[model samples]
Target chain A: MAEDLVLDTAIRDWVLVPLSVVMVLIGVLRYFVSKLLRSSQTPDAKVVREGQLILRARNLRAAGGFIPVKSFRARRFYYTNEENGLLHVPKGQAQNPQAQMFSDPNMAMDMMKKNLSMIIPQSLTFAWVNFFFSGFVAAKLPFPLTPRFRSMLQNGIDLSTVDVSYVSGRSWYFLNLFGLRGLFSLILGEENAMDDTQRMMQMGGGFGVDPTKNLGAEKDGIDIIQHEWTLPKMEQRAEMVLRKLVK
Target chain B: MVGATEEARLNQLESQVDNGGGGAWEYLCLVRKLKARRSEKVLRHGIFILNSHIARSKLGGEEWTLYEQVAVAAMDCHRNDIANDCIEALSKKFPGSIRVGRLKGMLLEAKGAWPDAEKIYAQLLVDNPLDQIILKRKVAIAKAQGNLAAAVEYLNNYLETFMADHDAWRELAELYISIQMYKQAAFCYEELILSQPTVPLYHLAYADVLYTMGGLENLQAAKKYYASTINLTGGKNTRALYGICLSSVAINQLTKGRNKDEKDSADLQPLAAEALLKDYKERAPEKLPLVTAMLRNIKLVS
Candidate 1:
C-alpha cells in the first residue's frame, strides 16, 4: 500500500518545512509590496457626497423619532420627493455616461494598482513552484482523503492509481499558499495584505456600483419608518424623575 | 513639568496601560479625552507616547488616528516642526490623500502662509465641493486675516447648504454677537433651539440675546425662554433663575401703568423667586441670605 511507503524525514526538512517558510516569507513580502503600491488618492467628490448622503439618510432613519414631527416630515419630504428630490434620479442621468456620478477614472487606475500588487507575486510564485518543485510527492496528509480529492490533492502527478492523500510537490506548495492564511494572520495581524482571499473578494467588489441605485435603496429604506417622536416621552420621564414640570 | 493633577492623570494613564487593563489605543483615547482642549499637554503626551517603542508596537491601526490627533494639536500649539513630521509620515502612508492634503493646508495656515493654505484648500474644495472641513478652514482663514465680512459671507454660504449644521449656526451666532448684530444672533439661536429644542444652553443663549435687544415684547419672549431654560435645567441653572427675575422685573416696570394682569410675568415671578431661594438654600447655604435679600429687593419674595 502507498501508506506503507515511509515519508522520509529529509522530505520534512527539504520540502515540507521549506515550502511553508517560503510561502509565509512571500506573503510578508506581498504585504509590503501592496502597502507601497497603495494609492493615496481620495475618492471622487460625488462618491464622497453620495457616501455622506447615505450616512445622513441612515442617521435620519435612526434618529427620526428624536426630532419633531414637522421636522421629520420635512426631511422625509426633502429626501423622498418624486420630481426633484436628492434621491430622485432622472431617467437620462441614471444611464448617462456623461454624468458626474459615472466619471471616476481614478477608480479604474486604483483597481489596476491593487491587481498588480496581488497578481504579480501570485503568478511569479506559481511559476517558481512549478519549475523547482514539480512531479514529486513532497508531503502526505496524516489523514486519508476521499476519491474526489484525488485530482485536487495530487496535482502534477499522472498515475491515477496513486492514493489521493499523497500530495505532490507543486500541490504541496499550492496547499501551503492557500492554507497558511491563519498562520500569516497570526504573524501580521488581521486584514493584512498577505490575505489573497481578501484581495480576491476586493478585486470583484467595487466596480459598476451605481451610487444613485444606493440612494434609491436608502430612500426606500427611509420610507417605511414610522417616526414616533420620542423626545416628549423622554422629557416626560425627566420630569417624572424630578417630580415637577417647570411650567 | 507636570502639575499635581496632571501628574495624577498621567500616572493613572500609565497604570491603566501597564496593568494590561487598557491597550495602547485606550491610552491614546484617554490622552485625547484628558487633554482635548489643552494643546500643549496633548502635544507633549502624544510625542511621549508615540516615541515609546513599546506602545508603538501595540498601536496597530490606531496609530494613524493618534498621529492625526497630535498633528492637529501641534498645529493648534503652533509647533510647525512636529506637525510637519506627522503630516509627512501620514503622506507616506496614504499618498495623495485628501485628508492629508487638508492637514498640509492646516500646517500652512498655522505657519501664517495664508495664500498657500488658501490655494491648497481651494484645490481641495474643487475636488470635494461639499467639504465641510475645508469650507470651515476657509472661514477660519478669513477670520485670521481680520476679514470679518468675508468670514461672515463664507459662514452664510456654508449655512445655506448645511442648514442643520448646528456648529456653523452657533459660530455664526457668536460672530453676529461679536459684531453687535443681536437680531441676527437671535435668529441663529432660534434656529438652534428649533432644531434642538431640548438643549438648555441654546435656550439660555436665545434668552440672553432677546434680553440684550430689550423691548416690551422682547422681554416677554426672553422671559419665556428663560423659563424654558429653567425648566430644561430643573432650576439648577442659577443664571437662568436670575434671568427670570431680571426679565420679570423689566416686564413689570415696562407694563407699570398698562393692563399688567394679562401682559406680564406677574404670576410666574413668585414661583421663580421661590425656586431660586430653594436652590440657594440647598446648594449654597451661606449665600441664601444674599439671594433672599435680592429676591426681596425685586419685591417677588415679599
Candidate 2:
C-alpha cells in the first residue's frame, strides 16, 4: 500500500486558518456594504391600499367564522363583486396602456444596481483568493470521500497521488463561504445579510421588484379561494361543548 | 471584550440609521436601540427622534403600526404622556381605524379604567364583531376583573372562531384549573397535546391533571405522561420527577392484585423516580426538603 501523506502544521496556520478568518470577515464586510448600497423605496399610497385590501380579504377568508353569516356574505360580496370589486383594475388603467415590467426604465435601473452589488463583490473575492492562495492543499476532511468528489475537493491541485480527503485552498474558501452562516447569525441577528443561504436563494430569482405581477397573482389567488363561511356551524360546536361542560 | 462586541453591533446599527436603510425608526429597531442604550435619557432622546420622523412623514405604509409600537413602548417605560400623544396622533390620522380604537382601549386598560376599556371593546365589537383583537381584549378585561367564568366563556367563544390559537387554548386550560375544573382542564390539555404532541409543557400539564384526578387508570396514564415529559425535557422538570413517584405509588396500591406486567411497570418507576429526585436534590439543595416531603407523603399513602 502507498504511504499516507502527512500534512504540515504550517499549512493549518498559513492557509486554513487565514482562509476561514478572511472568508468570515469578507462576509461581514459584504453584509455592511450591501446594507449601505441598498435604498429603501416607500410604496405609493395606492399600492399600500391595494396590499392592505388583499390582506383584509385573506384574513376574512381565514377567520370569517367569528362573524355572522350576514356579515361574512357582505364582506365576500364587497371583495368579489364584478362591478366594483377591490381586486378589479381601475377603468383608467384598463383603458390606458400599462407599461411592461421590462420596458420600465426605473425597474431596469434597479435590476442593474442589484446585479452590480451581487456580482462585483463576489468576482473580486474570487479573484483575490485565486491569485493569492491557489495550488496549495490547505486542509483535510476527517471523513474519507469517494473518487467522485476528488475534483471538487482538490480544485486548484492536480495530483493523482493526493488523497480525496485533502482540500485545496479554493475549496477551503468555498467551505467557509457556506459554513459561516451560523457563526454570523450568532454575532449578528437572524436578519443580517451575512447569511449566504438567503443570498443564494435571492440570486436564484427569488428577489425582485415587480409589484404589478405580485398584484395580479394576489388577485388570482383571491378569486379562486373557496369562501366557506365558518360561522354557521360555530354556534353549534360551542353549544355542544357547553352541554358537555354541564354534564 | 463584551463591550467591544457590543460597540461593534451598535456601530453597525447606527450606520444603518444614518443611511436610512432598513426599518431604522420602526418599533423593532427602536426596541433594539432602547435595549442597547445604557441610560433612560438616551432612550428618551431616541424616542424624540422617532416622533420627529413620524411628524415629518418619513415613515411609510405601516406608520400606524410604528406609532402603536412606540405607544406600547412608552407605556412600558412609564412615559404615559408620550403614549397618549402618540395615540392621539394616530386617532386623529385614522379616525375610524379599528386598530387605533383597540390601542385606545389598551391605553384605558393600562390606566386602570377597566369599565371604560370594556365599553370601548364592546363598541368596537358592535361595529366589527369578527375583530379578534377586540374579542381578545374583552377576554383580557374579564380575566383582569377576576371573573373566571366570564373569561372562560369569552375564551370558548374566541376558540370557536380561532381554534388554532394555542395561546387561547393554554389560557382556557389555566382558567379551568383556576376554577378547580380538573376534568375540563384535562380536556383542554388533551386538545393541545393532540395538536402539538412534542411540547413538554402540554405533556407535563396533562400528567399533572391526571395525577390530581387519581384512579388506577388515571395514575397509570399520569405515569406514562410524566415519563414522556421527563424524556422530552431530558429529565429536568422537577414536577414530572415528583409526579412519577406519586403516580407509581398510587398505581401500585390500586393494582395490588393486578397482573405481574402492570406491577413490574409500576415497580420500575419508583426506582428511576428516586434516582431523579436524588440528582435534582443535589443539583438544587434548597428544594430537597420539598422533594423529600412529597416522597414521604406518597409513601404514607401507599
Candidate 3:
C-alpha cells in the first residue's frame, strides 16, 4: 500500500485559507447583491386579503379544540360554505385564471429575476475559483469517504494516485459554500439571503412552485378536512385527567 | 411642543426603521430608551413623522397603525400628552376603525383606568359582537385585574370564536394551572401537543402533566413522554433528564411484585437516566448538587 501523503503547510496558508475566505466573501457579497436586486413592490391589497383569509382558516383548523363546538361549527361553516366562503374566490379573482405555469407576466418576471440573481453570482464564483485556484490538493476531510465522492471532492486535480480523502481547492470552495450558512446567519441575522443551500433549491425550481397552484392545493386540503368539533368531548377528557390527577 | 419640521425629520428616521434599513444600534437605542422610561424622544420622533406625513398629504390608512404604535409607546413612558395626541390623530384619520377604538381602550388600560377600558371594550363588543381584538383585550383586562375566573370565562369565549389561536390556548392553560385545575390544564396541553407534536415544549409540558398526575399508569406514560422529550431535544433537556429518573424509579416501585417485562423496561430507564444526568452534571457543574439531590430522591423511591 502507498504511504499517506503529507501536504506542505504552505498549501494551507496560501490556497486552502484563501479559497475558503473568498467563498465566504462571495456569499456575503451575493446576499447584498440579491438584496439590491429584490423587487420593492409589496403584494397588492387583494393578494394580502386572500392570504390573510387563508391563514385565518388554517388557524381555525389547528386551534378549534380550544373553542366550543357551536363556535367551531359556525366558523367552519363560514369558511367552507358554498356561497361567500372565504376559500371561494369570485370569478376572475383567482390568482391563475387559466391554472397554467408562467401564466402571469408579473410572476414570470419575478421568477426570472430570482433565478438570475441566484445563478449569476454562483456561476461567477465557481468560474473565478476554477480559473484561479484549481490545480492543488489543498485539504483532507477528517472522515473517510467512498470512491463515489472522488470526482466531487477532487474537482480540478486528475491524479489517480491521490486518495479520495484529499480535496482540491475548487472542492474546498464548494464545501465552504455549504458550510458557511451558519456563519452567514450569525453575522447577518437568521433571515438573510446568503444561504447557499436555499439558493440552490431555488435554482432547481423547488421554490418556483407557483403560488396560485399552492393556493389551489390549500383549497383542496381545506375542502377535505372534516370540521369535527373538538370541544364536545373536552369536558369528559378534562374530567378523566382530573380523576387521574387525584389518584 | 415639537415643531412640524423637527417632527418631519424624526419621521424620516422612523420610516427607515420601519423599512428594515435601520442599524442594530438604532434598535438597541430604542430598547434602552424604552427601558429607561424616557420614551419622550421616541414619542417626539413619532409625532414629527405623523405631522410630516399629514403635511405632505401622504397620510394613508396604514399611517394610522404607525400612530397607534407611537401612542402605545408614549403610554408606556407615561407621556400621556403624546399618547393622546397620537390617538387623536388616529381617531381623526380613521374614525370608524375598530382597531383604533381598541387602541384607545388599550391606552385606558395602560393608564390603570381599568373600569373605563372595560366600558370601552364592552361598548365596542355591543357594536360588533364578534370583534376578536376587543374580546382579547377584555381577557387581558380581567387578567390584569387578578380576576382569574373572569379571565378564564373571557378566554373560553374568545376561544369559541378564534379556536386556532395558540397563544389563547396557552394563556388559558396557564390560567387553569394557576387555579389548580390541573386536569383542565392537561387537556389544554393535550390539544397543544396534538396540534404541534414535534414541538419539544409541548412534549415536555405533556410529560410534566403526566408526572404530576402520578399513578402507576400515569407514571409509565410520563416516562414514555419524558423519553420522547429527551429524544426530541437530543437529550439536552435537564428537566426531562430528571423526569426520566423520577418516573423510572416510580415505575420500578409500582412494578416491584409485577411481571418481568415491566421490570426490565423500568430497569433500562434509570441506567440511561443516570448516564444522561452524569453527562449533564459534567456540562453544567453548578447543577451538580441539584442532580445529586434528584439522584438521592430516585434511590429513596426505588
Candidate 4:
C-alpha cells in the first residue's frame, strides 16, 4: 500500500512539477521579452501617437500623397494643432479635410505604392502567422478525446499554428510577427512605425463599436477614436462623397 | 480581447503553474493559449496594415520591413512550412506575397512525385486541416495517383471541415464523374446546386450526373438544367462537352420519331436545322477529338 501511494505521488509529480516550472519560466520569459522588445524611447502614449502621425506624414510624402479633387469642389487649409502636429487642412470638418491636400496624382501613386509596399507583406505575414499559430495551439492541445476530436478542436483556432505550436510556442508568434513587421518596414521604407495594438482594436471589431463600451475609447485613452472626438466638417464630407462616386 | 476559450485555457495553464502539480495537459493547453495569443497579435498587425501607414506604402520597398522580419522569423524558427501554409490564409489580405508562393507551388506541382509530396502534405494537414494550399495539393496528388477513392474520401473530409467551400464540392463531383461513380457524382452536384442555386454550371453538372446515372425519374430536372446551361453559355459556346448534348438530343428526337417527321415535312425551316446544329455544338465542342471517336463508335454500331 505504501509503495502504491509512493508510485501515485511520483506519477502525479512527474506530470505536475515540470509543467509548473515550464509555465513560470515561460511567463517570466514572455514578460521580459516584451519589455525588451517594446520601445523605451517613445514611452508615453501621446508621444507614440505623435510619432505615428509624423511617420504617417513622412510615408504620405514618400508615397506622393494626393486627394483627387477639383479646387472649386474642395479647398485646403493648413492647421497648426500641435496635438495632430501639422494638418494640411482646417481641423473642424465633416470629413478628413486633409485628404484634399493631396492633389498630385504622382504623389497619390507614390503614396499608394508606399502603402501597398508597407501593407501587403505585413498583412500577409500577420494573417499567415495568425492562422499558423492558432492552428499550432489547437494541434498541440492536451485532450482526453480522440485524435480526430483534437484536430477538430484545433481547426477551430486557425491554420498557421499547426506546425508552429508543435516545435515551440515562444518562437511561434515572435517569428511571424517579426517577419510581418520586417516585410512591411522594407516595403514602406524608413521611420514609419506601424502600431499593431491599434490595428488589433480595429480588427477585433472594437474600432467602430460604440466608444463608451471599450476602455480604449475613453477620452484619455487614445485619439484613434477620430470620428467621435473630432467630428469631420461639411466641406470635407462633400469631397468625400464625390470621391466615392468616382471610385 | 481574448475569447472564452483562450481565457479558459490561460486559467487552466495558470492553475497548473500556481498549483505546481499540473501535468502534460496543462503544458499543452498553455502552449495552445500562447499560440492563440500570438495569432491574435498577428491579426492585430494585419489590422494595423489596413488602417495605418502600412496600407499607404509602395510595393516591394523598405516600408514592408516588418513582413521581411516575419519571413525571417518564420524561416529561423523552422516554420518555413507554416509560412508556406500562410500563402493561402493571407491571400485575401496580402495577395502579392501569397500569390508569389502559390505560383511557385503550382510550378513545383507540375512535376510528378506527388505521392511523395502527399506524405509531406499529410503532415501539414495533420497540423492545419483548413490550409487551402495543402488541401488542394492533397486532392491533386490523390487524383494523379488514380486513387479516386482516396480523393473522394479526403474531399469529403475537407468539405465537412470547410462547409462553405463550393470549390471542394465541385472538385469532388468532377472526380466522381471521372471515375464513373455516377450516383455519388449526381448527389454531390445536387447538393452543390442547392447551396449555390444561381450558378448555371452547377445545374449542367447535375444534369450530366443524372443522365450518366440513368435516373429516368430525374430526367425532367436534367433537361431543364441542360437547357439552362445552354442559355447560360449563350447557346453557341459549349463547355468541353458540346458534342454529347447534341448527340443525346438528336438520339432523343429520333427515338421519339419526331426527327423523321421533321425531315420529311417541307414546313421545316432553316431555323430548325440551325437549332439542331446548335444543340449538337452545345453537347460536344466540334474542336474536341472525342467527338470524332464517339461518331466512329456510332457508325460501327450502325
Query: Best lDDT goes to which candidate?
Result: 1
How does residue B193 of candidate 2 score in lDDT? 65
Task: Quote the lDDT for B86 in model 3.
Answer: 81
**How would you class the docking of model 4?**
incorrect
**Segments of candidate 1 deviating more than 4 angstroms:** A1-7, A96-105, A123-194, A244-247, B1-35, B42-134, B145-149, B152-279, B289-302
Tens digits of per-residue lDDT for model 1 on A48-112? 66665676677678756644465578778988899877777777677543343347566566767
Note the residue pairs that clash in candidate 1.
A40-B95
For model 2, the docking class works out as incorrect
Consecutive 10-residue window with the lowest summed lDDT within model 2 chain B: B37-46
For model 3, residues A92-162, the per-residue Cα lDDT tens digits are 65544434445668766776778776777778888888897898888988888888899999988888778
Give the root-mean-square deviation of each candidate in angstroms.
8.3, 16.8, 16.4, 30.7
True contacts kept of 1: 0.03
Q: What would the per-residue lDDT of candidate 2 be over residues B1-302, giving only the tens digit for each residue? A: 13566666666766665566544554245445445533243235446555575543765645666566667767667677878988998999999988888888888888879989988888987776767678888898889889889999999987755655667789999999999999889867765664565677887898898889998767766777776676666666767766777777777788775646454344345555565556756788888777667667767322
Specify the CAPRI tier of model 1: incorrect
Error of 3 at A54 (Å): 13
DockQ: which is higher, 3 or 4? 3
Q: In model 3, which runs have C-alpha deviations exceeding 4 angstroms?
A: A1-247, B1-62, B76-81, B257-261, B286-290, B300-302
Sort by DockQ, top down from the best: 1, 3, 2, 4
Writing each residue's lDDT as its tens digit, candidate 4 over B75-110 gives 334455544444434444565453344333443344
DockQ of each: 0.07, 0.02, 0.02, 0.01
Model 2 misplacement above 4 A = A1-247, B1-63, B76-79, B257-261, B285-302
